[model samples]
Structures are given as C-alpha cells and as structure tokens.
Target: MPSPTLTRVRQAYARIEAVDRPEVWIGLRPQAEAEQEARAIDARVAAGEHLPLAGKLFAAKGNIDVAGLPTTAACPAYAYTPWEDAPVVARLRTAGALALGTTNLDQFATGLVGTRSPHGAVRNALDPTRISGGSSSGSAVAVALGIVDFALGTDTAGSGRVPAAFNGIVGLKPTRGLVPTTGVVPACASLDCVTVFARTLPEAEQALAFMASPSGRELPALPQRAPGPWRIAVPPRAQLGELDEGWAEAYEAAVERLAAAGAEIRHLDLTPFTDAAAMLYEGAFVAERYTAVGSFIDKLIAEGDTGLDPTVAGIITRARDIPAHQLYADQDRLAALRTRALTQLGDADALLLPTAPGHPTLAEVAADPLGANARLGRFTNSTNLFDLAAVAVPAGLTPAGLPFGVMLIGPAFTDERLARLARLLQPRLRLAVVGAHLSGQPLNPQLLSLGAEWERTTATAPVYRLHALSTAPPKPGLVHVGEGGAAVETEVWRLSAEGLGQLLAALPRPMVLGQVELADGTHAPGFLCEPDALPGTTDITAYGGWRAYLNH
Candidate 1:
C-alpha cells in the first residue's frame, strides 16, 4: 500500500490538475519530490515520531522564497531562483507541511485588486466573474478551494485579508515582525507581514505558531483565551458609506452576530483609521514601495521591457518624485494617527470591521483599476501602519449570493486574543433587549460588564405593546398582547448562562426575563414587564423603540 502521506500528496497533485487554473500558481513542486518528502514523513511517523502537519500541503506567494522556485513577485524580468526557503516557509516545512509551489501575486506586491500581474488574474473560488482580492490573491483562492491546507502571502496593504474575504477563507495577518521576512521580497519592508491563509481560524492559528520567530522579537505571550465579555469596537454607520448595496447589510448582520456572541459593542470614530489607510498610497509609504523594486523596474524600463504591469509601474514611478522631507513629514503624520486611533480604541478588547468595503467584479476593476482597488483596501490598509494584528473570517453570503467577511483586529501582539474572540463569532444562544440594555443607552454598560454581546437590532413580533415606566433614568416595559399590538424594535445579544443569571438577579421590580417573540418568528429571553404595572405606565408603542420615545 502507498504511504498515507504519499497518498495525500498524490491526491493534492490530482486536485491541482482538476482545478485547471494556471493563473493561480506561478510554479509547482515536482510531484516525485513531494512524494519523496511524504515518504520521509511517513517513516518518521512509523518510528513513533509525531509531526503535527504531517500530510499538509501549502503554497507560498511568489514574493516569498521557496527553495528551487523563482521569487518573481509576478514580474518575470525580476524573477530569480532562491537557494533557500524564507524562514517562515522553512519552519512550516520543518513542521512537516509540504510546499507545493509559489502562487501568483500582484506584481511587486503593489495592488490590492490581484490583476496587476503578467500571469492572468487569479479568479475567485466561488464566483469566477469577480476578482479574487489580491496581491495575495492566489494564496487565498488556493486555500478556499481546498487545493492546499494553508498558504503564505505577504500583507503590506490589504493584500492578505482582501483576498481571503473575496475568496471565502481565513486570513491571519500576524503582528508585523512576528514572522521573519529575511528571504521575502520587500513591498514596504517596514510594514510588510507574512500572512497566512487557511480554511479555518484554528488551522491558521496553528500555522502561525509554526511560522512565528521564537526569539528575534521579545513579544508579549499570546493569551490562551480572551476573558469573556470582550469589548469589540465598530465604526459608526456613516463610516461605511463605501460599502456595496448588500455589503452594509451584511456587515450589520455580522455585527449582530458578534453581539449575540456576548461582545460589548463600542462605537468608535474611524477617521483616524481611514486616514491612516489613505496614507499608505497617498503619503510617503508609496516611496517605500519604490525603494523595494523601483530601481530594478527602472532598469527594465531603460532596457525597453514593457512586461511590468502598467498600473504598478506608474505607481512606483510617481514615488520617484517624492522628496526625503515629505517622507519624514508623512511619517510624523502617521505617528499622530496611530496614537489617536489606538487612543480611540481604549479599553476595547478588539476592533471588528468588514474585511473589505465590498467585493468587486473583474469588469468593475477593469473599468477603474486604481479607484476600485483603492476602495478594496479602505478597511484593510491601516492595519500595519497602526501596528495591529488582524484576522479575517468568512461571515456569510450576501443577498446577492456573494461571500462576505469580517475582521477582528487587535494591538500588535494580541494575535491570540483576537483568535479567541473570533471563535465567539459562531452561532450561540441569543437574548433580546428592548430598552435599557440597548447599545449607547444608560444601562447598556451593565450588560457589557456582565459580558453580554449585542447581536443585531430587530423588532418584536408585532404582538407586543411598549410602555414608559415611572423610574429613574426611565425604562421601557414590553407587554405581549394577543391582539391589537405593534412591533417594538429591540436589540439581540448573547450572554453566558452565568452572565444571564447575574443579570436576572439584579432586575428591578416589574421587569422580568422571559421568552419574547421576534418579528422574524424567533423567540429569545428578553426584557418584559408584569401586566399589573400597566395601571401606572404610559403607552408609548407608537414611537417603535426606546430611543425613538426618548427623542420624541
């Protein structure tokens, strides 16, 4: 019988042949070599040695070095064979993960749209008509399609996360410097992070551990788990103006899901974050991109080679004109924005955001490459600038049947903490808050303190009457009426049983926790009032919800 490891390797090669998308990979490891490595792993396993990633197959982005493969960064004229694997790739191989090949990337790792390469655009795994978000496009698509267990891509802007979002997979952009970049081509050497794309968060986390340097940077120990009742910051609704038709709704749905998972929702102004994103290309950061390969590109231009992506060439060429003083000035401005953004996020466990503003189609990007690609990076570009760790996870499908994703971002070394929080984003028991515990309301912090997460804003089942009670700070009393009732808006939340018990123990008179029916025909434990209290209450159902009544 063939060795199990060798069998898996053969299967992977077979799948690659079936995928038939030449654009996704720039180079692939020879099948015989991979099978030989697999046999060695099987031999070790038979000898009682344990290899965690024994049968795993992975790919490296073209910009990253993989022994015997050319490091092209999608520029054929700039390609060169690397003698050794980058440290990250070397570590993964050491852990028994096989490198299948170097995947395609945006030339020089300059664009987010994934189309800036001589190799054809890497198509989306789900919708071929749409772009597979790029510079890390092929890495993400490979993982999404299960062609590999995991893949490596460098994130300078949103290269890592955008591709994951568009392709429906997990993208973990580790804290910059956590993974060594010794053998990888530089896009922005200062901000570049070796990112990992995997089908799931746990797998990505495991891969990241194998890739992280053990002693180079003395970093904080990753938290085993983030303590419950996490404070997850989100931007105000207005900040999401760039989201596509169904994307905003998709994001709101994701926010609701996070809340239902027991996170405290904190509204933060994203001006600082968005401003930092703009600085990546609009400021001196572009000069860093030039510093990476501008001279080589210039040499090619001098030699009359037109193979470089025109858009990428134009971007680097423009950076040649930025003065040294301007770079320093922009650096200072970035420092200020980073300080302000982090300050605004004070006390929050992590910031949750839509992975990308929207998913764009190939046609959309083709019509306006620069503008569409810039928009794709709107939410992702500032991560490295702020020195944060980010993990992008597939949220769900949009109304248009396209994939949507949300990212969990935290301080530079909070990778583990963000991972812990990401697990909560899955389905969980829900609770409804009709009044006092609504987000931004007076009593909302109480629920937050108890680790209750706000899920989504919804309404009752058009069979409840709302009233204003005579109390301190004022509270709304929801009463279920068999007939002649109105739908009262409510917020859904998730809380642990311990948290729910704590909340129940502190309830004031007449307010009780009971099953409340929602407009969507779902029922959840929610705030209700004893009917006896109606004698002294003033009916306020006409206003719809507590906030509306207060405003009136």
Candidate 2:
C-alpha cells in the first residue's frame, strides 16, 4: 500500500473503532480487504492515472448492494448476499472510493426515525442522546463522525435529508433517476432517489458526479458571471408550523445571511407543496411502499419471522390494501399539485426551508415514532414529490446546542444552482483580486495553477482604496479605508483550502491576504499591502482599478 493511503485507511478504521458505535454499520469490510483495495489504488496512482476520489473511503447504506457484504436492509430475515455491487456503489468504487462497509438503516428503508432498525438506533454523531434521523440514519452519522470521506444513502421521503440535519452535514439528494438504482433494494422505487452525505457541499457534489450515470440528464451549467442576486422563495412564518425553541430564530438568521449575500428572498404560499407532502404517506402514494417490499415482508411474516420493525411492517402491511382506485385518484391530485407548486416556485432559483422541524431526542422518537418522523419530513417529503433537487447544508446551532439546517429546493436538473446557493449559505474561502491577479492579467496564472475558479466580478464595499504598489509585475494593494473610500473594482475567485495554503506560502512580503468586505455584504481573503510598502506607492483610487489605471 502507498504509505499515505494505507495510513489514511488505518486512521479511518481507528476512528471507527474509537467511536465504538456498532449500530453505525451493519457490516464492515475486513481491515485486510480494505488495505488491499487501498494498495491497488496506490498502484494506479503511482502509474500516473488521475482518480477523482482517490483514496477516499465511503460507506453504502445497507439497502444498496456492496459486493462481499450481504444486502441486509436492516432486516436479517430479508437479507441476501449480492454477488455484484449496486450500480451506484460500482460507479463510486470505479472512481477510487473504497467501500469501508454497509451501514445500518431503518428496516427496508421505512422510517424517518433511525430507531426502526433491528441492528439498533443510529446515534447522532453530535449527541448520542438525540435521534440520528433515518432510514439513511447510519449513512449520515458515518459522514458526520468523519469515519469516512462520504456515504451513499437512499431518499424516498426525507430519509436522506433529515439525517443530515440531525448530524450537521451536507446531504445532496440528486434529481430523480440521475443516479442509477440497479441492484439496490427498493423503498418507494419510483420516488426512491440516491443521496450522498459529506462534510461539505463540494465533496458531496464531487461524489455525486462520480456516481451519476453518463446517460442521465446533465445538470444545467452555471453562468460564467452571476446575472444578479438569486431569487430564493421562503414560506411564511405562520406556514412554517411550530418550530422548536431557537429554531425559528436560527432559520431566520440563515435567511438573513443569504439575503446579505445578495439573494432576493420572496415570500411564497406553500399550500401546494405542503399538501403534496401530506400525500406521500397520508394519501394513496403509501401503496408504492407496499409495492416495493410487501411481498418479501409478507412471506417473512407468513413464515413466522419477526425481524422487521413492527412499525415498518405495519406500514407496508396497511399500504398493500390501498385500493388501486385511490392510487389513481391521488396520482391525479398530485399531478395538479405539482403543477401549482411549480407555478408558485416559478422564476425563483430555489425554495429555502428548514431541513426538519427540530432535532428530536431518542425518547421523543420512541414515544411517538410516527408523529416525530412525520414532523421531521414536513419540508423534505415534498422534494421528490415535485421532482425537484435539493442540497441540505448546516445553518447553525440552535441556542439549545443542537445543530440546525436548511435546504435549497430547486427544479429538476437545477442541481448546480441549488449547490451554489447552498455554498453561499455556508462559509467559503473566496479571494478578491484587484490587479495583476484579475482574469487574463499577468499574475492570474498563479491562481489558475492553484485550481481556483472565478466566482464573479464585483467591487469592494465603498470602504476601500486601490493603490499601485511598487512591485514587479505591478500588483495593486486594496487598502481598507473607512472614510472617503471608493468602491474599488475586483473579481472574486473560489479555491480549495489547500490552494489557499499554497498561496500564503508564496505571497510576497508587501502583499498580504486579508479580509475584504464586498459590495454584496460578504467578506473574502483579498490582496492588501503592508503600511511600510505604501510610502512610495502611487495613489490610483481615481482610476477605479489596476487595468483602468494601466489603460489610461
């Protein structure tokens, strides 16, 4: 094994062992087997081949098949060993993501409460006393605990989202059918979409790309420059239902942050969307759950097996008898609701909502599994119902010390937009350039070499002055002057954390990276000059920017 990859693998295993949360995984790949996979990846890396997910470790939800691990779906009675990996798993593995294990889940992917699993309730990584949100419970906890780089889960009705909210991570539930579902156990098959959980939006997006089918519809490309502030729709406070203590304020704070970052928030009537969400289980759509695993569970019950969670079994059993006529009638109602919901969402880039009503305790979930789980899905269940894409990001912690989150819901194929909006709501390492490092300038190549991408062209908040520093290649210094300052022209660039380190390492003495407040109320690391170097610098504030000064 290449030393780093092997070392990382060992550390991951060590973390998993240290956690001692057996419920987080239903089965783990033998340490030796994982080591062998890492060694093979090292050999490929040594051969100069690029692997996007190189040396990355990830866990697959048990409902999804991973070769050598029995596809248990958290129901031992229904367990079966699959000879091949599921399509999603295969794609991720091909991208060099080593599988560490198959995680636990609500039996047959049924509950939004992680406690339905016979393996045991998946505990929240942030607080063991809290419920981890389910049926993708273990998957989210695994990512949140940093036991793996990322994880794969399935979302039929908020399974992918709620867990992320409880655990405080990014959960990207792609547009339906974007990631192939072959070789995976069905939950509500048609609406069952695969999801990825990572500590950040970018990592989740990267893993999604590796797993997305080539033949699937391509995500819409983002504009080279932002046209204007994003139009984000939010439900009225009254329609948000009863929020937990501090959750309402946390959500408003998240919205305010987005607004400060230049998003135009529009009040929206959520009747259509919320009504459709009710239909997922409350309406005839529940029949689909029965269609997925009813027969298997029925056979198990007939054979006198009691492996499935009683609540899960009761749900599927009742769903089997939902009249076909009711299914058709509800389907028609959903069609109309989808249209109305989309209309209400028209022209808006995305709909922002809390990922869950609140973080529930294990006792709360156990006390009222149905009520608690239903409340958790209040905002998320409608996503797939509307055929929309969503990105759940951590908003902040509630005053009560529990993590809170919000999700951006966008139209189908708008995955990129949703992710971009999600990033805006989170912290980012963006750099502002006023001079040679601006696009097409002499020193711009340094940024490109560090894998930076241009974010947008804007100006510093009218509180900065530009100066032509006496440096080779003629870099400009952006001085933060509180009074009589001009809105200096600049471009923002987004780069990786490692790229930032490299930039700091090679930074010239006179130029230092410091926080620059932008016109849009956001701040970024920007090029500034030391006071000593400003003595002989030419005052160029009147010229607006370095290029303009040079052109004159």
Candidate 3:
C-alpha cells in the first residue's frame, strides 16, 4: 500500500540505475537509504502532518555537503566526508525531500564548463555531445533528465543559472546570504548563493523558501507580485552579444512573446552590468576562491598529485599574486559598480536577458575552454556580483532542437516577484479578487488550495464601485460605473487555467468572473456582480475596500 509519491520515488531510482550515466553523479546514496526516508515521510503523512515538499526527490551539487556523503567539489583529492548536511540540504530533508546523491561539478567549483572534473564531464541531457553548463553541471542535468524532481546548486558566478539554461530547467538563485553556506565548499565565499533547479518556477520557489534562513534577516519581505503589464528592461540590440543563428532566433522570439503577452519592453544600456561581471574573474574577487582552497591545491601540487583540472588550477593559482592593495582596489571599484547597477534597476520590475549567448558543443568547450565558458556566463556572472535574484527558465528550443532559455533578474529579495513574472511566460492567468479572497481573509485558503499566488493589491482605474452583496457568508461585489465611479481596492492573484475553471464553476450566484480594469488600465479576470442582482446590496464604495467596510 505504498503512496503514489513513494511509487514515483522508486521509479526515479530505477530510472537512475537504468540510465547509468556515471558522469552525472560523483557519489550516490543507496536506494535503501532513499526508501527508508520515503517510508518515514509516509508515516508522517499518515499521522496528519503537512509536508510542503512531501516525498519530493532531490540532489545536491557535490560541493554542498550531505550527511555521510563525501564532499568532493568534483576533486577527489580535496574531498572530505561531512558528518552533517549543509544547512540548506538539512532544511530540504526536514521538509520531506529525499536526496538521491551528490552530483558532479566543475573541479573546485571554479569552471563554468562541465568538463573541469575528475569524475568526467557531464554531457548535455538533451544531446550528449553538447556541453552541460557548470559548475552546477550534473545537478542541472539530473533534473533535466527526470532523474530528480529538483536539485540544489550553488551560484557564485553563474554556476547555478548557466547549467539550468543549458539543460532546459528553471534555476532560482536567491539573493546572497539568503541560504546559509555553512557546509558548502566556497568558490567566492562572499558572492556564493545556494540555488535551486526544477521543472517549474513555483517548484523552485518552494524549495528556495524552505532553504532560506528562518531568521528574517536573510529573508527579506517577499516581493509583492505586480500584475501586468510588467516593465521589463532589456539590452539594446547592438549591445546583445553575438549568438549562433538558432539561439538568436529563439531569443528574439522570446522577447516578442513577452511583448505580446502585455509586457512593456524597454531597452537599456547593459555596460554597467557587463562591466561588473568582468570583475568577478578579472578583479580581486578571484582571491576569495584562492583563499578557500589555495592551500590544499598547493599541497597537491607539491606532492606531484595535481589531480585538479588544469584550467581550474590555473585560475586559482594566479590569485596568489594578487596583492592586498589590489584586492582593496577591486573591492572599492565593485562597490561603485554595484551602486550604478542598482540605480539602473530603479523603476523596472525586472531585467530580461538570454541565459547564455548560445549553447556550445563539448568539442567547442574542449577547443577553447575559457572563451566558451565566458560566453556562457555573459548574462549570469553579474547577478551575484550585484546581489540580485535571478530565475532562468526554458523559453523554447533552438532550430537545431537544443534548448534556449531566458533569465529574469531583479534586485535582492525579489525572488518571489521574479517567480511571478516567470509564470507569465508560461501557461497561467492573472486573477483579481476584490473581497474575501484577499490574503489573510477567511476565504483565502480556497485560493491557496487552487495554487493561486497573490500578485499585488491594487485599485480599479477610478471607475468602479464597491457593493456589499446580500449573501450568507457576506461578500463584496465590484461594479463598473464608467466615469463617475471611485476606484475600488482589489488583490490580484495568479492561477493555472484549470484552476480558473474550477473557481468559475464554484463561484456563488450573482458573483461572476469578468474583466475588471485596474488603476494601471490593465484588465484582469475579477469578480463582478450581475446588475439585476444588485437590488439588495448595500453601496459601500465610500469605504474604498472590503476590509475598510468591515472595519467601519
């Protein structure tokens, strides 16, 4: 009598063994261990416990420690067995997620290409010959190939997002320090962030929320979701980097789609962001990586057991010569650049960009590792450097049938907002609720059960009236009155089309879903009262909102 979730977990393990992709995992937990965890979760479920992530399968990048697993950071010589899981991993486990294994990464978590590992390069999930972007390489591929529901990856300079872009998954890189790095091997300690990769934005956001620090300090107020039309910033056409024909076409199509879906696309100068990205590797921040593992690398070199990836070794080794003064200078420069970048993001909801310039074949990376890797991080490196939250989602496939992705970037703590925006790029609808259904209201649970996420609270465009409808539970109705009406307060929520249908079917009499215009002049599906049925309703437009009417 195994639950369906347990059945899926078993099926996932079987698929993992059947696939037999050795390069995807550096170390795997025994199937017995996973089963035991799943059984425990089922027991908890039977006891009536609510688990947000009940029975979800997940994997962690090798650098993020798991209890009883060797944390190699993709370098066996530097591997260490940790007695406890990384804080982020522990959080997921507590929420009922089962870890399958530790996935491969670029050696020392230094390279963006997947090949910088002793375990072997992680091939693209879709086409093995192409590169799987790294240093979170295998974590992305695991989720991409359906081996896991979601996986943990760390982002320093694009490791989390780049791999997701290449593999056609949703990658969420939370603001720096939002997820603790206690048990993770550092690349650039100050810039590193624990990121999540999943098939959908909501799933990724759920994992991120569970992993975030419980203390409010690391978790900022979740961004209030803003209903469309979203003000999306983009780089000028001339500023866009050169891309292969297939990627260029796909990226352009994505932009066109966003515009068609009611987004106000604004082109801006991207030099400041790009300039900040260059500083991650070219500036003194590189010293942070050296500080984390330089000694171990030196020891390996001295013993002539230099089992490290040559490219990663070279990158870390060069940091030794960075004088203290140079590091200070770069820090100052970075601070100024951060200010400029934040200023540029002033009023825009989010910046939209190609996740990577193009997808490169494994042969391309082998021929020119540095160049190929650099190109892959073009839109990603600056995200951490500037302390921004980012979500990379699959846009569609290239003409060559390879995946193409786009990233939505926003200021720190905008993880929730970015997820909301990302959903617009998918199959969902924006719903406006005027009464009872607002957050914290008695009827709010119904919307939550329908997978509805509150976008924002706004008002009608000074052309609507509020009326307290005569009903047993007592709900308010939003009525349109053209030019003489006062704006009525409303909360906008998002839901899948199926959820909308269910909501419409369940709506009580006199209440129907219709177009309601917001103050911004954008129309969303909202509750409206049938004019003939308003005879018994009380005019409460003077109070402005349902909550206000109730309080008065």
Candidate 4:
C-alpha cells in the first residue's frame, strides 16, 4: 500500500500537470520516477530509519544537475546530461527528498528578470501578468504554487533571493562555499552560492543544513544569536532609492512592526554596501561571468547559432574588452569596501532591508529589460559580494495585492542566526514549554484549545534553572540564571497573537510567560517564574525537566 506521503507527492505532481504555466519547468522528472523515489522513502520510514526530509518533494534550477535531467542553465544549446546529481542535490536525495524536475531560469543565469529565457518567461505563481523575479524564477514559482516542498536555486547576484521575494516565499542564501558547488553550472564561479526556497524559515534552514558542506573549508559552523533585543541596521531614508508606492509603504510598515517586536532599528549610511553592489555588474565582476562560459559562447557564435539571448551574449562579449588591470583594480577596491561594510555592521545582529525596490509588471521589464532588472538588485546584489548570508521573507502584500518582502542579512556563517531572527517577523510566535503544557501532559489541552501546534522537542540552554513551583497543579518555572544551570527538556509550540493572549490571560501567579533561553542561545516565550518565587520552590534543575521530576 502507498504511504500518505507518497499519496501527497502524487497529488502534487498532478497539480503541476494541471497548472497552465508550462514555462515554470524546463524538464520534469517522469511521474513514475518521482513515485518510485517517494515509495522508497516510505519504505525507509517503515523500517524505522529517520530522514530529515523524508518524502519531501523538491525542484532544482536547471543550472544544477539531477542525474537524468539535462543541465540547461536555461539555454538549450548549453544543455548536457549528467551521470550524477550535483553534490547538493545528492545530499537532499540522501536525506529522502524526492526530485520533481529541473525548473527554468534566465539564460546562462544572466538576467535578474525571468523573461530572458528562450523557453518562455516564467509567470508569477499568484498573478500571471507580473514577472517572476529571476534567474531562479521557476524554482521559486514551483515552491510558491505548492508543487514542491522546497527548491534549490543559485545566487551570485541575488538570483535566489529576488525570486523568493517576488513569489512570497522564504529564500535562504547561505554563506558562499557553505554548500558545495560541484556539479552545478556556474555564472560566476568564485562568487556563486547555492540557495534554498521554501514556505517557512525553519524549512529552508533544514534544507540548507542537510546540503551544507561538511569539509569546513569555507563552511564554518552555522552561527546562533541569543533572542532578546536584536540590533537591526536599516539604510538611511535618502539611500532607500526609488520604490513603488506600495513597496515604500510596506517597507516603512515592516520597520515599524520590527520595532514593535523589540528590535532596535538603527539607520545608517549604506554607501559601502551599495558601492560593492555596483562592482558586481558595473565593475570587474562581470568578467567572472565571461570567464566561466566565454569560450563556449564564442564557439556558439562562430557556428552561427544566434539562439542565445542578445542581452546575455552582449554582456559576455563586453567582458573581452575590459583590461586585465581593471579587474585587479576592482578587486583591490572591493577588498577595502568589504572592510568598511563590516565596520558599518558592528554591533548590529543583522541588516534589514527591502528585498527589492519594487514589483514590476511583465510589460515594464519588456520595455527596458536591463534597467528594470538592475533596479531589482538594488538591495540584493551587495550580499554575495560581501560574503554575507541572507534570508528573504514575505512581509505582506502591496496595495495592488502583489507580494512585498524584506531580507535579513548577516556576516558569513550566520545563516541559521538570520533564520532565527526571521521567525520572529512571522505572524506566529514560537513558545518553549518545559512543564505541564508539554505534549501528553495535562496542560497540553490549553495549547490545543488556542489552535497551537506542537513544533519540536528540544532542550533549554544550560544557563536555565528549572524549579517546581508550589501550586495545586505543580507547574515548572524556568529561570535564566546566566551560569551554573542545567539543560532541561522542552517542547516548542507555535500559536497566533490571539492564542498567546488567551494563554497569558489564563496564567496563574508566579508562573508567567517570559523569554527563556534555548540550548542554542535562541530565545522564545516560555514559562519563567518571578525571582522572588524561585527561592521557595524546590530546585528540580537536577531532574532535567518537569516530566523527569514528576516520574521521580
């Protein structure tokens, strides 16, 4: 019998077939192949093996190899069949993620707008008339449309993030070299980083963790940030550039929301980051794209195959005219600017910015392809250039109902930290419960009544001391004593503001909801007792958790 996961995978494939947008995919795996993979995962699960992504479906940008699919990079002339999957894709497969197919992208992954592909521009999943930001257009669309659980995209100059913003999804651009690039087509070999698109921050993080390179050459351990008052840097108003009226309003509103959520918003001059962004295409970095495929382009042109997109071909051709000294000069300038950028980020946990200046329509991009595309990169291009990790998340919708999004960027190896911060911006709040409210406990019904969903089983940071308060029900109170505390087992539950309010209203004295530090240093609203009450309570800290103490 087919498992429920396999059944869902089949339904997803059916939905893909039913959709009208053909250009969203360049190559789709046969239904039989996908089904087989799903069944294999189900069998593994039945046998008691744990798979982080068991039965989850995913798509890869055509630029990345997936064994049976041709790696086209959105240019048919450049397509080649690979005998093995890209290292990242192989890792996902090993984690039990099934491949749906290879999705479309900008030709040679050269354009930020999706229209540059000869296969046809990928339409926005929500509104077909608008442009799906690219060159990761199709991958983002696949996730947005619910055709896949997550998808792999490549980011050199914001290809991964822009698309996610436009599609109202989470885009996680890991630090460069955190995930292996082997077996993937390169637009800019040195600067490129594989990225993930998913519906939630945790989902994207999970995918990234599995795909991240273990060699640790440039893949330092992902960083964690303690949750509390987060210091976030924003660009000065004058440097925000021109934005669509809806987007402009949305950005300001987003900043206000973050401030309300206890974030310290600091306005700063963004010239250093902006200058580095200019260096990507306006300076010597364009030459790197040329170096990657210049000879192949030259060969195609010599054979009179004018099938390549004119803009892509023109961009590569111009690189040949750039003096070698100009490349070195740009490198030197970039190195100095990087230092300034780092200095500007001092004391700031992350830099929060609009994902893109505006959402343009298909007609607008068709009118001035290059200019419109360049504008989309205003906030994104500087990221990979500065070796930053970023997560683009949906903020809300524009006045016209188009999706508006923002990005959280941090220094290298801070990918997980950025995701943790991004979670706070989401509508739901994650609360860590250590005592009676844990799953299967008496108070668990309170969570279920408020529409709360259990998220995961975890442990508190060793800095927490757990005490059993003297009450009729005997609840546990977690206190952050800074040091000499014990790690306690806990459960995380997600709930809405109204639900949280209900929970707060029902709370008894001495046991109030406050920030509790997790083992990873991230904070969540959890059960904490007043310092005065801690002295009279029995120290159940040695018991590790409420359940353990109750059993004893």
Q: Which tens-of-lDDT digit does each residue in 265-286 have in candidate 3?
A: 8877798898888888888889
Pairs of residues clashing in candidate 2? none
Residue 217 CA error for candidate 4 (Å)?
Answer: 2.9
Per-residue lDDT over 1-552 for candidate 1, one digit per residue giving the tens place of the 0 to 100 score = 887778778878898889887899998888999888899998998998878888788999999999999999999998899899999999998888889899999998989988888999988988889999899988988887768889999999989899988887788998888899899999999999999998777678889999999875677665454455889899999986677888888888888887887778989989999999998999887998888899998999999998889999999989988999998999899999999999999879889899888888899999999999888888899999999999988777787778788899999888888888877664334889988789999999998896777778999998999999988878989999969999999999987544665576468778988999999998999989999998978999999999999998
lDDT accuracy of residue 91 in candidate 3: 91
Off by over 4 Å in 3: 216-228, 427-552
TM-score of every candidate relative to the true structure: 0.77, 0.78, 0.76, 0.78
Worst 10 residues of 3 by lDDT: 216-225
Q: Pairs clashing in candidate 3?
A: 225-455
RMSD of each candidate relative to the true structure: 15.2, 10.2, 13.8, 13.7
lDDT to native, each model: 0.87, 0.87, 0.85, 0.86
- Per-model clash counts, in order, read 6, 0, 1, 2
lDDT pick, better of 2 and 4:
2
Summing lDDT over every window of 10 consecutive residues in candidate 4, give the lowest-scoring window.
216-225
Span of 10 residues, lowest total lDDT, candidate 1: 496-505
Error of 1 at 421 (Å): 0.8
Summed over model 4, clashes come to 2
How far in Å is the alpha carbon of 242 misplaced in model 3? 1.1
In model 4, where do residues sit more than 4 Å from their true spots?
A: 218-228, 428-552
